[model samples]
Target: MEAVEEVAAPQVRQCPECGTEVTVHVRYVSWCAACDWNVDPGAPDPDRGRLAQVRRRLARRYGEQLAEEVARGGSAAGRVGADRSTVLAFGLALLVHGVTAGLFLAAAVLIIGGWHTGIQPVLGGLLLVAVAVLLPRPGRLPQGAPLLYRADAPGLFGLVDEVGAAVGTAGVHAVVVDASANAGVRTYGFRGRRVMFLGLGLWEILTPQERVALLGHELGHFANGDVRSSFVTHGALRTLGAWHSFLVPASRGNLMDWLLNTLLFLPRWAVYGLIHVLDGLTMRASQRAEYLADAGAARAGSAGAAVALLDRLLISEGVEAHLRRESVTAARAGGGSGGREAREAAERELWERLAARIGSVPESEYERLRRVSARRGHSVDDTHPPTHLRRRCLASADPRPARVVCDGPRARSIAAELAPARAALARQVIRDHAG
Candidate 1:
């Protein structure tokens, strides 16, 4: 008998019947052990096997094209990971608290000195009152105008409808927020369904497919019930941070401020330290959450496209930078009919600039910093895994290590079928309801 060909270890053979890729080091045979399909050179697993072969062939070709695009200056953008809005809000609140506390401390010092510091107390009280009134109101989001309700845009209403249909669930509404470089879904009210929030700039930066992936990821959070947990965690952090924001400024002085200059400098590091701890927990959850979302996007359809888009976004300098560079590069690249190509050129230019600006770090210096950062294992109070980790997570074939969902070609098919419908619904939700 002719020797049965064996695919190398780890790299599994693509399934002929289901188009699912698999690996087996057990034994070489004339047919697939899992599906009982022919493996003989002349008699592959019938028509299904043939189809599988075709899919792989096409995927390989597409992969090559994508690689070329990347080589020729097609780079992905980065998501804005920092919660700038929250940080600013916290900062302002802290300033108010610190100023008020200082005033009180000064007045008490004067009283002790028998100088009758009555004005200080009045000023302190008024400042405290003003902060109390303003703190509860919405401060700002990272992007967009203000609110992200779907009723804001009419043209994209059809997109939302499709997403609802795919999940076979309701109590979900979509909105567009003027937040910075982030997009996500949330749930509010007693019912606790998914409340989707899309960033205004996200779509402008992402291709339609990538946008779908992002939406799917958010929806996945709802599907996986991570949204509730995340909200709970976020709420707790917010509450604690707020408390620190208020009290730290108050605590900056011991009895000394009363005895001396009465200066109550805000404890910036102390508050930030607490935040970093909270952010660490949030970051761990976030990494897992991203995987789930990626899966959701896969389920919605277009897994390859979704992954491809992610690769694109994550590799770029970032969305904000892209926006800053867009106009200048567009004018320079001028009159190109190919949008994708033009965009690629712009991104390539941007990266080259950034790389140049970053300049050449000495090999030894780069190594030292890399080691130090790794040892530190994430920054204080940032809810994100390292960028490298994120790239690996998104690139993973089986995202859920615990509960293994389908993967390889089978997984791709399932994702491809559902992605379009889901994407359409998402668009609609944002357009019709973001008012």
Candidate 2:
């Protein structure tokens, strides 16, 4: 149950007529309070207004469903609920691994046993060896392992430990800071050790309270046992994908090659189809795990902060897009060595502008986001629930007050500790964009 990143929430905007902040209304229409400016002029269309109302009703209904599920102590209640689909997915993954392991074992036996036998056994051994070689190796950490920097900041580690303890999970084995705009926890290493990655993009935008909620949400995944199952399933999927690729015929050379390709096609197709089915089956449970983690976050911080964190993610999405565009534009404008610095400066400027804009966003916009998200519903590929459903579920759940462990000063210390790595990553990003 690695934490899955949710869609970015809605962004805040200023009044178009004047520079004054605007208020968002139903259907996400913006109006200037000061000068009577409206982003959508004229009276709110009744049809659009009705659609908004319908969206709200759907969100509320979904929220109620989630609340009732929580009340009934279903899968949403905690991490201990035994989900059959998850178990099935895990079992299927183990089955796939077992089959791969058997192939290797069979190859070993053929090679060893054939030493005293005739050439037939040796030929069989060689064939098995070739088959094993062709099979895709299990997915592992990337070379050089981007974003795997160890967190040495005492304050940051202390806060992480506190959050883990609060959420009833073993403390993370390591913390990583990445350049991406998302945070997640995944199990790594031979022993399935949990590692948490905090995105710098996400970090820059969040307030201390919101950050706490985010951390809690991630740590909660480990606490609920989602990490282990998710890691296994992910590994299995990767193995299956590799097998599929290997079985695909690169060329139709000779009769034997065609025969081999034809023989492998059915199995590969079956594995591919099985992967999709297992993925669909397990998706609901994965989503429930998300809601459970959200509940943990609500308990660790406040529901309000949890909801605000989701909103800020949307703002981060917009800011990230703008930054990338600006960086590329600057590089292409012939700034050369100075272009990198200019891009970084532009990034900082955009962040500040976006952060300021967050305050001016009308509450109605948040509601609109929730409504739209609710109406959209969950897709098979979605790892997290709709933002509005999450908000509603959190609002309905009981709240627990907790102190904010990673406040501004401590967060600053952490940024300072990781400054070198962040700088290196920034350069890499600049090069990537420029190239």
Candidate 3:
């Protein structure tokens, strides 16, 4: 008997909604990264969507340029001029604070010396009061901060330590697990010890390799010294904001009050403008630092894994939105009888759907996502680069073999270890949602 001939998958020319190349798997329904367009192979094409088509075309062109840049050995590596930028940002932060301090000291000296008598003394006193009110209070750790329960996952902590060592940092001081769809490392305490917060929602969706990539990216921020400069600049900006808030008069009062407010207004406005400028500068530095951290992630894992982690993050955002909608719908239907349990069940269902969707994402589609994400620029205040730009940077970097091992068994063990903390956090989230 003749062997049955194997059929090749059909080639997808363009997305019915958006004109992006659907590269592989034309037979199956696929998602377009450019416009979130879903292509149904068996369904009839709807009306021609010109706007999405135009956008996709522009995105493809831009992506090609970025790819060419990567090929030409562009400076996608995080190390290029990162140290200089960090140093400059830190120095500027110090200089701004130093100048403010000098002014305060000079004002104090004048006030104490009794250089101005009579009304001058009264004005000086008012000035001192204003300054004191405007001064920024030292930041304190939140009373119940380190919000998530400390993970009992020794394997997870060991993985973190491996990544930390790879990045040349001592290691995180603590590891906390939460139920939210996020992961980050923060500096805490007077000593500025690093604390890693791992979100179970994010963890549940990621593959073992992607988990390493996420951890590496967060730890990379500390390894690259992003937190220190960020803290200083952010503190300075907050102080300026406090000054602006206090100096602005809430209402017109007596003639003397009005006069004093008028006198303070210009300086306060100047401070506000300075804050905007400084914040913009620091934001740029922060964006650069993010790219550096992405590079560090690439170093800790493979370039492919780093990029895949970003893609999963974007996918997870969509999943979260869907989960929230489901929660609201379920709550409305059941009159919120089961509360947390119902929500948890819905969450589980949503996660299963998310996992299936992630598993079905094609390589070509992920690449398209990288390109499209790069085309969209962030606002001035945003600290991170666009996801596509981050992916592009990672793609340009040399692929590194991951040092830590996180196979299926290991991943399961880690999850099991954190089960208690995850359950507690999940309950908290459900309660918060119900309320």
Best model number under TM-score:
2
Top candidate on lDDT is: 2
lDDT of 3 by residue, 96-203 (tens): 677667667767766777765655566666767756754545433344322433355567778888887877676776776665678887767667766787776687
Model 1: residue 337 alpha-carbon error in angstroms: 27
What's the C-alpha lDDT at position 181 in model 3?
73
Q: Tell me model 2's lDDT, rounded to 2 decimals.
A: 0.64
Ranking, TM-score, top scorer first:
2, 3, 1
Residue-level lDDT tens digits of model 1 in 1-435: 011223354336777786655554332232343554543333322344654455434433333343333234332111213344334434544554455456556545544554366665565556456445433232223342334344543334334444434433342444544323566666555554445565534443454555556666566666554321444345445545665655444445677645432332345455555555444434433444444455566555455645654444432324455345444544444445675565444433432333332232223223333333343332212233343333333454443221212335543443344333334433333233322
Clashing pairs in 2: 1-226, 1-227, 1-230, 9-314
Candidate 2 residue lDDT tens string, 1-435: 011212335545686667876543433456554664542343432454654455444444544565568767675686645567677887888887777778777777766777677774677677586556544343244344244333456666777778888888766767776667788887676677777887766776678888889988988888876622565677677777777777778585999998898898888789778767666556566667777888768767677888778776644555566446544764664466676566665443433443444545557655544444454542212456566566666776666676455667787877677666566655555556657
Q: What is the C-alpha local distance difference test score of candidate 3? A: 0.62
**Candidate 3 least-lDDT 10 residues:** 1-10
| TM-score of each model, in listed order | 0.42, 0.74, 0.70
Local distance difference test, each candidate: 0.43, 0.64, 0.62
Off by over 4 Å in 3: 1-88, 103-151, 227-231, 249-262, 329-371, 378-381
**For model 2, where is the 10-residue window of minimal lDDT?**
1-10
